[model samples]
Target: MFQIGRIIMPSPLLRRLLAALVLVTLALPSAAAADCYVHYKAKRTNPYGLHYGIIRVSGGCPSSPGGLVQSRISSGGWTILNVVKVTTSSPSSSERRSAGSHYYR
Candidate 1:
Protein backbone atom coordinates (compact mmCIF):
# COMPACT_ATOMS: atom_id res chain seq x y z
CA MET A 1 0.00 0.00 0.00
CA PHE A 2 1.19 3.55 -0.78
CA GLN A 3 0.22 6.64 1.23
CA ILE A 4 0.61 10.34 0.33
CA GLY A 5 1.34 13.05 2.85
CA ARG A 6 -1.33 15.66 3.55
CA ILE A 7 -1.00 18.53 1.06
CA ILE A 8 -2.01 21.94 2.34
CA MET A 9 -2.84 25.03 0.28
CA PRO A 10 -2.55 28.71 1.26
CA SER A 11 -5.90 30.15 2.32
CA PRO A 12 -5.03 33.85 1.86
CA LEU A 13 -4.27 33.45 -1.85
CA LEU A 14 -7.58 31.72 -2.55
CA ARG A 15 -9.53 34.33 -0.61
CA ARG A 16 -7.84 37.20 -2.47
CA LEU A 17 -8.64 35.65 -5.85
CA LEU A 18 -12.28 35.17 -4.94
CA ALA A 19 -12.60 38.74 -3.69
CA ALA A 20 -11.06 40.11 -6.89
CA LEU A 21 -13.51 38.18 -9.04
CA VAL A 22 -16.46 39.55 -7.07
CA LEU A 23 -15.23 43.12 -7.34
CA VAL A 24 -14.85 42.84 -11.09
CA THR A 25 -18.32 41.44 -11.51
CA LEU A 26 -19.99 44.17 -9.45
CA ALA A 27 -17.94 46.95 -11.04
CA LEU A 28 -19.27 46.09 -14.48
CA PRO A 29 -22.70 47.66 -14.62
CA SER A 30 -25.50 46.03 -16.64
CA ALA A 31 -28.99 47.03 -17.76
CA ALA A 32 -30.25 45.34 -14.61
CA ALA A 33 -31.20 46.90 -11.23
CA ALA A 34 -34.23 49.06 -11.85
CA ASP A 35 -34.38 52.68 -10.63
CA CYS A 36 -37.83 53.18 -9.13
CA TYR A 37 -40.43 53.00 -11.92
CA VAL A 38 -44.18 53.13 -11.43
CA HIS A 39 -47.09 50.79 -10.75
CA TYR A 40 -49.64 53.15 -12.32
CA LYS A 41 -53.11 51.75 -11.81
CA ALA A 42 -56.56 53.02 -12.71
CA LYS A 43 -57.02 53.82 -8.98
CA ARG A 44 -60.74 53.00 -9.41
CA THR A 45 -61.05 56.63 -10.54
CA ASN A 46 -59.33 59.07 -12.88
CA PRO A 47 -58.32 62.72 -13.18
CA TYR A 48 -61.72 63.41 -14.78
CA GLY A 49 -63.45 61.39 -12.03
CA LEU A 50 -64.41 58.69 -14.52
CA HIS A 51 -64.79 54.96 -13.73
CA TYR A 52 -64.60 53.72 -17.33
CA GLY A 53 -60.98 52.61 -17.39
CA ILE A 54 -59.22 49.29 -17.26
CA ILE A 55 -57.42 47.87 -14.20
CA ARG A 56 -54.21 45.93 -14.51
CA VAL A 57 -50.86 45.27 -12.82
CA SER A 58 -48.20 45.51 -15.52
CA GLY A 59 -44.68 46.57 -14.49
CA GLY A 60 -43.45 49.18 -12.03
CA CYS A 61 -39.83 48.74 -11.06
CA PRO A 62 -38.88 52.40 -10.94
CA SER A 63 -40.60 53.60 -7.75
CA SER A 64 -38.05 51.75 -5.66
CA PRO A 65 -34.83 51.09 -7.52
CA GLY A 66 -33.50 49.30 -4.50
CA GLY A 67 -36.68 47.23 -4.37
CA LEU A 68 -35.61 43.69 -3.69
CA VAL A 69 -37.05 40.30 -2.93
CA GLN A 70 -37.87 39.19 0.64
CA SER A 71 -37.88 42.93 1.29
CA ARG A 72 -40.24 45.11 -0.76
CA ILE A 73 -40.72 44.09 -4.39
CA SER A 74 -41.18 40.33 -4.50
CA SER A 75 -42.78 37.89 -6.91
CA GLY A 76 -44.61 35.65 -4.46
CA GLY A 77 -46.32 38.62 -2.78
CA TRP A 78 -47.78 42.06 -3.56
CA THR A 79 -47.39 45.58 -2.15
CA ILE A 80 -50.35 47.95 -1.71
CA LEU A 81 -48.43 51.12 -0.92
CA ASN A 82 -46.66 50.85 -4.25
CA VAL A 83 -49.95 50.93 -6.14
CA VAL A 84 -50.61 54.22 -7.96
CA LYS A 85 -52.79 55.76 -10.67
CA VAL A 86 -51.76 55.50 -14.31
CA THR A 87 -51.90 58.71 -16.27
CA THR A 88 -51.61 59.31 -20.01
CA SER A 89 -52.66 62.16 -22.23
CA SER A 90 -54.13 59.63 -24.66
CA PRO A 91 -57.16 58.05 -23.10
CA SER A 92 -56.74 54.99 -25.30
CA SER A 93 -53.22 54.37 -24.02
CA SER A 94 -53.64 53.95 -20.30
CA GLU A 95 -53.10 50.85 -18.25
CA ARG A 96 -52.02 49.82 -14.75
CA ARG A 97 -48.72 48.17 -13.87
CA SER A 98 -46.55 47.12 -10.92
CA ALA A 99 -44.78 49.89 -9.04
CA GLY A 100 -41.66 48.42 -7.46
CA SER A 101 -39.15 46.08 -9.10
CA HIS A 102 -36.54 43.76 -7.63
CA TYR A 103 -34.20 40.90 -8.48
CA TYR A 104 -34.03 38.21 -5.81
CA ARG A 105 -33.69 37.92 -2.09
Candidate 2:
Protein backbone atom coordinates (compact mmCIF):
# COMPACT_ATOMS: atom_id res chain seq x y z
CA MET A 1 0.00 0.00 0.00
CA PHE A 2 1.18 3.48 -0.86
CA GLN A 3 -0.19 6.90 -0.01
CA ILE A 4 0.15 9.65 -2.56
CA GLY A 5 -1.21 12.86 -1.12
CA ARG A 6 -4.84 11.97 -0.21
CA ILE A 7 -5.02 8.95 -2.52
CA ILE A 8 -4.26 5.40 -1.53
CA MET A 9 -2.78 3.06 -4.17
CA PRO A 10 -2.99 -0.48 -2.86
CA SER A 11 -2.44 -2.78 -5.82
CA PRO A 12 1.01 -3.96 -6.96
CA LEU A 13 -0.42 -3.99 -10.49
CA LEU A 14 -1.26 -0.31 -10.13
CA ARG A 15 2.28 0.39 -8.94
CA ARG A 16 3.71 -1.40 -11.96
CA LEU A 17 1.41 0.55 -14.25
CA LEU A 18 2.48 3.81 -12.67
CA ALA A 19 6.14 2.88 -13.05
CA ALA A 20 5.63 2.08 -16.71
CA LEU A 21 3.84 5.36 -17.24
CA VAL A 22 6.72 7.25 -15.65
CA LEU A 23 9.27 5.47 -17.85
CA VAL A 24 7.29 6.19 -21.01
CA THR A 25 6.90 9.81 -19.99
CA LEU A 26 10.67 10.08 -19.48
CA ALA A 27 11.23 8.54 -22.94
CA LEU A 28 8.92 10.93 -24.81
CA PRO A 29 11.46 13.72 -25.24
CA SER A 30 14.15 11.47 -26.73
CA ALA A 31 11.59 9.98 -29.11
CA ALA A 32 10.58 13.47 -30.14
CA ALA A 33 14.27 14.20 -30.76
CA ALA A 34 14.53 11.54 -33.45
CA ASP A 35 15.44 12.41 -37.04
CA CYS A 36 13.16 14.70 -39.06
CA TYR A 37 12.51 15.52 -42.71
CA VAL A 38 13.03 18.89 -44.33
CA HIS A 39 11.39 19.90 -47.55
CA TYR A 40 13.04 22.86 -49.25
CA LYS A 41 13.54 24.78 -52.45
CA ALA A 42 17.03 25.50 -53.78
CA LYS A 43 18.73 27.04 -56.76
CA ARG A 44 22.01 26.68 -58.57
CA THR A 45 23.19 29.30 -61.00
CA ASN A 46 25.52 28.71 -63.93
CA PRO A 47 22.97 27.43 -66.37
CA TYR A 48 20.36 28.68 -63.85
CA GLY A 49 18.24 26.00 -62.22
CA LEU A 50 15.86 25.30 -59.37
CA HIS A 51 14.75 22.22 -57.46
CA TYR A 52 12.63 21.11 -54.55
CA GLY A 53 13.97 18.47 -52.20
CA ILE A 54 13.39 16.43 -49.11
CA ILE A 55 16.30 15.64 -46.82
CA ARG A 56 16.54 13.69 -43.61
CA VAL A 57 18.20 15.60 -40.80
CA SER A 58 19.49 13.50 -37.97
CA GLY A 59 19.53 14.55 -34.28
CA GLY A 60 16.13 16.23 -34.72
CA CYS A 61 14.77 19.21 -36.57
CA PRO A 62 15.95 22.70 -35.77
CA SER A 63 13.66 25.65 -35.19
CA SER A 64 15.16 27.08 -38.35
CA PRO A 65 16.46 24.49 -40.83
CA GLY A 66 17.63 26.76 -43.65
CA GLY A 67 21.24 27.07 -42.53
CA LEU A 68 21.60 23.36 -42.03
CA VAL A 69 20.00 22.58 -45.39
CA GLN A 70 22.26 25.08 -47.13
CA SER A 71 25.34 23.54 -45.57
CA ARG A 72 24.34 20.03 -46.57
CA ILE A 73 23.71 20.97 -50.22
CA SER A 74 26.51 23.52 -50.60
CA SER A 75 28.97 20.89 -51.75
CA GLY A 76 26.85 20.54 -54.90
CA GLY A 77 26.73 24.34 -55.32
CA TRP A 78 23.07 24.61 -54.47
CA THR A 79 21.74 27.50 -52.39
CA ILE A 80 18.67 27.00 -50.26
CA LEU A 81 15.90 29.45 -51.12
CA ASN A 82 13.47 28.53 -48.37
CA VAL A 83 12.22 25.73 -46.23
CA VAL A 84 8.90 24.44 -47.57
CA LYS A 85 8.12 22.28 -44.59
CA VAL A 86 9.56 20.24 -41.75
CA THR A 87 8.02 17.03 -40.48
CA THR A 88 8.76 13.67 -38.94
CA SER A 89 7.03 11.75 -41.72
CA SER A 90 8.78 10.82 -44.96
CA PRO A 91 7.78 12.54 -48.16
CA SER A 92 4.94 10.97 -50.12
CA SER A 93 5.39 9.42 -53.56
CA SER A 94 4.23 12.60 -55.24
CA GLU A 95 6.64 14.65 -53.19
CA ARG A 96 9.47 12.25 -54.01
CA ARG A 97 8.68 12.56 -57.68
CA SER A 98 8.65 16.32 -57.47
CA ALA A 99 12.01 16.26 -55.75
CA GLY A 100 13.35 13.95 -58.47
CA SER A 101 17.14 13.82 -58.24
CA HIS A 102 17.00 15.92 -55.10
CA TYR A 103 14.97 13.37 -53.17
CA TYR A 104 16.44 12.19 -49.87
CA ARG A 105 19.61 14.24 -50.30
What's the TM-score of each model vs. the native? 0.21, 0.78
How do the residues 15-104 of candidate 2 rate in per-residue lDDT, one tens digit apiece?
899999999999998888888999999999976889999999887889889998998999998999999999988789999999999988
Name the TM-score of candidate 2.
0.78
Cα lDDT tens digits for candidate 1, 16-75:
998999988996653243233223222112233211222222233333332332133223
Q: Which candidate's TM-score is highest?
A: 2
Off by over 4 Å in 1: 1-5, 20-35, 39-47, 50-105
Steric clash pairs (candidate 2)? none
For model 1, the local distance difference test gives 0.34
lDDT values of the candidates?
0.34, 0.91
